[model samples]
Target: MKQRVVPIAVLAGALFAVNVVARLITRFGFDGDDTAQYRITIGMFATIGVILASVAYVRAQKSLPSEWLPSLAAAAIGGMLLTILVGPFLSGGYPFSAGAGNFFSQIWLYGGFAIVGILFGYWIATMLGRDYRSQSLKAFTAAKAGKPRRVVRR
Candidate 1:
């Protein structure tokens, strides 16, 4: 359990770090520029999505989705909370300075991206017939089809 948790926490921290880097760049490099801020935010979201998707893809190769999905979700949620709440302080701003709408919006955006990332990864795995469920189904069908048929007397 410790081994699993350490890696998950590390991954979550890494994801949060991406947000921190984006925030720093936006604050310092694009001060007072709404256009740049918007683009940076979108790019940050995409980066997180790509990270989640890659993690899912790699995990799918050796484990079932059920085994890793919960951990990934927990990590995402944890990292998101830190990014939204603690992140502002690093920029010398209050967490609620942006108002409740902004706070909730961040949550929604993060969650939506995480979900989409996981779905995209799983979809690709299924298409490639590499996911656990897909492989199991394939093997089951093959086994059934390969069995000899019984003949009935008329």
Candidate 2:
């Protein structure tokens, strides 16, 4: 439990930290500039994607998909919640200050980007034949090829 929770919590906190940094930049540097705020938000999302993608690539190398995927999902959700709920306060705004539609859109965007990043990482790992499943399959094939087949009387 500790092993699982600690990594997930750390990933979530990292994601939220990115949001805080973005918020602070926007609040201080572009308080009244809508264009700058939009650009910063997009940049924030891309940074989140890259972070998740790199983590996914590394985790895939170390653990089975069955073991790592759920934890990844949990971390993504935890991160999204922190970004959407606690982030606004740091920027002197409320969660729903932009209205419900914007709030929900943020959720959708976060989930979508997270999925895309994970998929991209998984694809790269698979292509490199370095992911857990690929390595296990390779080992199984090698072991099978090493053994001689027995002749059966028909």
Candidate 3:
């Protein structure tokens, strides 16, 4: 359990690091520009979405949430923290500079990204026939295609 937790925490930290780099880039590179900062945020969200979707699609064959969900949740939280705390700095302001507006926006953006990413991941998983729904569909398809009419036996 300790071993597992360590890796999950590391993964979370790594995800958070991605946000850190992005935030730093936006903060220093696009200073004082709302338009550029917004663009960076969208780019980060899109990147996260693709990553999560890929993970879900790949891991759909697995039956254990204990294995994946924790990692994902950890990653999301880590990323959110990095963005929220470091993002304002990247945007050329202190962490809580704009009163409630920036703080809330950070929360909203982080939450939005996580939700969107998870949905995309789940959707991919379903589409790949690895999820339960996909398995059912596969079974139905196989049944429909595998045989001609058969006589009922009592």
The model with the greatest TM-score is 2
Q: What is the number of backbone collisions in each predicted candidate, taken in the order shown?
A: 0, 0, 1
Q: What would the TM-scores of all predictions be? A: 0.87, 0.91, 0.71
Candidate 2 lDDT over 96-127, as tens digits, reads 99999989989988888899988888889989
The residue pairs that clash in candidate 1, if any, are none
Q: Name the best candidate (by lDDT).
A: 2
Model 1 collision count: 0
For all predictions, the C-alpha RMSD in Å is 2.5, 1.7, 4.1
Tens digits of per-residue lDDT for model 3, 1-154: 8966776566556666667777788877887889997898778767766666666555555645456766777777776777678656655677788788868877887678777777777776766557755776788999999989789999
After aligning candidate 1 to the native by TM-score, how far in Å is the CA of 80 from where it should be?
0.6
> Which is the better candidate, 1 or 3, if ranked by lDDT?
1
Pick by TM-score: 1 or 2, better one:
2
Q: How far is candidate 3 from the true structure (C-alpha RMSD, Å)?
A: 4.1
What's the true lDDT of residue 148 in model 2?
100
Enumerate residue pairs that collide in model 2: none
